[model samples]
Target: MKAKQLYTKPAIVGLTLLSSLVLSACGQSVESDGNSNNLANIKTTTLASSNLKFSEHYLTRDVRDDVFYFVMPDRFDNGDSSNDNGSKTIPESAGGFDKTSNAHYHGGDIKGLTKRLDYLKGLGISAIWLTPILRNQAVQGDSSGYHGYWPLDFTEIDPHLGTNADLKEFIDAAHDKNMKVFFDIITNHTADVIKYQECHGDGKPLFSTSKQLCEYVSLADKAAGKGYTPFIPKGHENLKTPAWLNDPKYYHNQGDSTWQGENSIYGDFMGLDDVDTDNPEVVKGMTEIFNNIISEFKPDGFRIDTVKHVNMEFWQQFTPAIIEHAKTQGIPQFFVFGEVYSGDPQELSKFTTEGDIPSVLDFAFQYRTKDVFAYEKGTDNLNDLFSYDTLYNDHNSSADYLMNFVSNHDVGRLAYTLDQSLPEASEQEKIKRFLLSNSLMYFARGIPVLYYGDEQGFTGDGGDRGAREDMMPSLTPDYNDNNLYGTDKTTADDNFDVSHPIYKKLAEYAEVYHGHEVLRKGTQKVIEHNDEPGIFAFTRTLKDHPSYTVIYNSAKSAKKFIAANAANHKVVYGEVNQQKNEFELAPLSFVIIKTI
Candidate 1:
């Protein structure tokens, strides 16, 4: 089946870009350079309090203002390799994509992640988002159920990952260290393997297939006259349903492929079958699974996977129930951010305006910023990105409580996205561009999610799956079977430096942001906007407090911009150099000025 036939119209993916047109569709306000960065330049004063009252749901949560560090359990570390079980390599997988197989398992689990909690805290990250943790089907010579997406049973944690008790303990420990946990949840589909009459638990072989079981008829497919098929062996299919639904021991075996279908028209997520969310049985099952997790682990929030693939009406109906359940369980302030995967703020507004999840990932900002910094376009591009405010600024609950991220598990890393065409430039020039881009994320509004291994400067240029590589111990090469890619940076003799200068600089700025409330919660203004290309400058002000003016010299050579209004500010946050009157920004440098 093709994506156009699956869940949503295939055009929905591109619809996000269309929605961007709704913002600043007519024209925008442009403040001039006079009293630029000036705290007093604001024509009207709207006051925001450090102690602003929030709906009970957001009261105990600080996620909206903190930096989120995302980790893939299997690729991160083997805290205790004893958890390593079965063959590391799975059968029928595409061979030698990358030795590390970040997508596959490598003995990472809750224990492994917890062992490094201190390391994350040291970097000023306040939240950690871990990938799925449920049990998946096991196959011989395969990575096994390593990545944890395949759900054998929503009720139990995969023994390979650890016990339910271990999961709860990980959350408790993270909270103790002041770190929030975002548990990944998948309600869209289940594993492909199903039951067989001949299969025996004792010595009988497990059935395995790359094809998966999906309801033959979905709304998207039915519209095109695709016929329906029963998922369970209503008569005989019920008997063929995986025995794991009957017994946990059979959950790992490779089951029959006869059950699978191609629900491609629905969404881009591959392999797993799309559920008929309209079915009350399906809704109830998913909701129960969600609430049970909330009650058991008490995750600070949830990162819902493939949200748009299902009906928004379903989300409008189901998400509220999930949030309400959390409150009922005495976890009133738990957060939820869905994955809509579009670059349109207007489209995302539909999700936020609904009374369910708090916010969706801010893909709009990610796309624009990519065009802005990486491409070195004009200052107008920056203005265009911020203009989305008309739709997102005033949400039902919090204002501007969206997730702002530059890179993640699903996209190419920022370093990978940076300009690699400058072969003649020195390493310092490369590092400068990297730090400048990261600085924007560190100081910008909303939650910032740092992809796993980004701080260590992991680089990859491939699409989604190719971007998710295992974190290397060091930046050196080592010849060993354990080092799959032969890109092992852990060896002592290899000088492949993993200490990314960009991450260190960003971490330092992140600390500064933590101490300043203004940057975290303030009214942002674009002091200067130009269409000439490159140069861009802006300011953000917190009522009754000093404002910050940021200037970026985007061209290949030094450029000049007058901070005429910037001089009036009381405190300037950035460096003051020799002949301070003329603040010189190196090519691609970003400077912050405090208005007296």
Candidate 2:
């Protein structure tokens, strides 16, 4: 295979409060902007993916062909600063834009995203996955819902981002360029409107005591006299849409969740009103709501939020309905994956099998291989990780569909992870680690999702607010103090530097990835692994196509291996250093060979 093109997202941070959906899952689409923000004049991408074309075998679109770029709308860009105040006179409804605080909105909207489509495309992206863009509870407590998680209205786009029509234009724009879009939806809970009097005293919404202190009372415990109750604030009873959400009967009222056993499924998420997913009315309502969302938005797929927190039965019913409904609406290839957040492969498999999710964010992939790439662990550790791939292989779901990522909105970035794990390491060493982590992700068996700002080498001090920096530029000290890869530019400066080393390096990798059908969809087998940091080789073979060998060196010094037919094989990436029986490898480097 010579070359083929396609697929790219930022991540979840508004992260979101979907409607009353528990265990709802969706899929990720791959994309980047073609405009490149005038980057055509800034610098020509040496391996710009525009020239690459997918083979005939992959002409039809599928989620696996995507490489999602997860973006938090508010932090990405500010195309229209006018809406930054949310077009409201009241400060509460305005969703305050405070560049001084990362917790507040910095005014990135759908318009900004629309303005930058070429930027993503020039970088080799084919799809876009934005964090919840649904109208949200603008101001929640002291923190703002700039990340789009606290949904005040699931029916509309947040005023701070743009109007619903603007979203349609953004989608239309992407589609015109042959890209897909995925909505990061939430169904487990809504914004924290339903509060407990037990925590807030006499229908008062504010409390000096944190809601986390409100002790949980399980349904079984409530049956035996230990009961916890919730109430709607006097004036705010009509807060939620679809009318049914205003009633207390629709919720579990099991108090806040510690994210432990019983409460994990039934309790509120960070005090947000948790939906009673097992209830019949709630189930039907959520199904109708998301189905309507699909019909209206016409997204290619969905990236469902908080699957594990919802009951399993909710998923068994919900996922199938979503897919079937999508088919009826003419979206036969609609994708649906969930956020399980667990690292155990066996437990991870359950969601795909019994839970009925199509795929899940590959947390197990990161957890299993993070140490190997970020730390000093042996390359052989990856064998144990890949061996568990079969666990996800079943009727409805397969390991191949898993959305692979090195870091996300909830988790700190690769830059931060590399620095934290190797605190004393040089900047170059950290860059090498970042590149390596992504290398494994790009060439691996799953759909690779690139977090927004990672290509710019954004170093989020940690996850959450720390990770959500402004791509346009920043005035925040917390973000400016941090270091970035390949550039001296801080968060205070505009970061869409096409000339940056990491960005170019990733573009090169994406070029290789999108160009090769086997690398994106082939079955992989470990050819060599060692207890020490050394050569880790694997074979990716698809039936009727030539087998390919992917090789890498995790060692600091050059490593040696032997490949007799190295000459016959076409070197797709990296140099082949051979001396009769042995070949040499650069530190933290890799090679891909299409074996004849």
Local distance difference test, each candidate: 0.55, 0.76
TM-score of 2: 0.90
**What alpha-carbon RMSD in Å does predicted model 2 have with respect to the real structure?**
8.9
* Shift in Å, residue 150, candidate 2: 1.1
Winner by TM-score: 2
C-alpha displacement of 535 in model 2, angstroms?
A: 1.6
lDDT of 1 by residue, 148-255 (tens): 666556766655566688788888887777677888888665654333332323233332333332323444544565533213322322221233233222221222
Per-residue error (Å), model 1, residue 3: 60
TM-score of each: 0.74, 0.90
Runs of candidate 2 exceeding 4 Å displacement:
1-45, 50-59, 87-92, 207-211, 564-567
